[model samples]
Target: MTNPLKTQVLIKIDTITYKGHSVIRINIPPQKEISFVGEKAFIREDSSTVEAKGPKLLAVSQLFQK
Candidate 1:
C-alpha cells in the first residue's frame, strides 16, 4: 500500500545558538508535512516537492518565502 500523503517544510531563521542549533522560529500551516534528515531537511506540499536543504535549511527557506 502507498504511504499516507504528507507535505513537509523547513523554515529559515535569522539566528542560531552557539551549539549550532537553529534559532529561527517557524509557523507551519495546517495540513503541511515536514521532515529533517541530518543537516538536510525536506518538505512536501500536496504530494509535490517543496524544498530540501542542508543544515542551513532555514536560510534557504527564507529565500522561497520572499
Candidate 2:
C-alpha cells in the first residue's frame, strides 16, 4: 500500500534567447522507518554539508509531522 504522506516537488526554469522554459518533477516518498544503511543525512553549514546525527536527526524528522 502507498503511504498517505507521499510528496512530490515541481521545479521550473525559464531559458533565455526565446528557448522557452524547462520543467522538472521530483518524487519524495515518506520514511516508513529509520534505517541508516548506506544513507547519511547532511545539512548545509556555511559552504559545506555536515553529517546529521543525534539531535539533528530528531529535528529533521520533526519537520514531516502533520
lDDT of each: 0.49, 0.54
- Across 1-26, the per-residue lDDT of candidate 2 in tens digits comes to 22233222222223344356554434
TM-score for model 1?
0.22
lDDT of 1 by residue, 4-51 (tens): 322322442245565777576644544333444444565655788655
Clashing pairs in 1: 7-33, 8-33, 8-34, 8-43, 8-44, 12-58
Give residue 43's lDDT in candidate 1 (0 to 100): 61
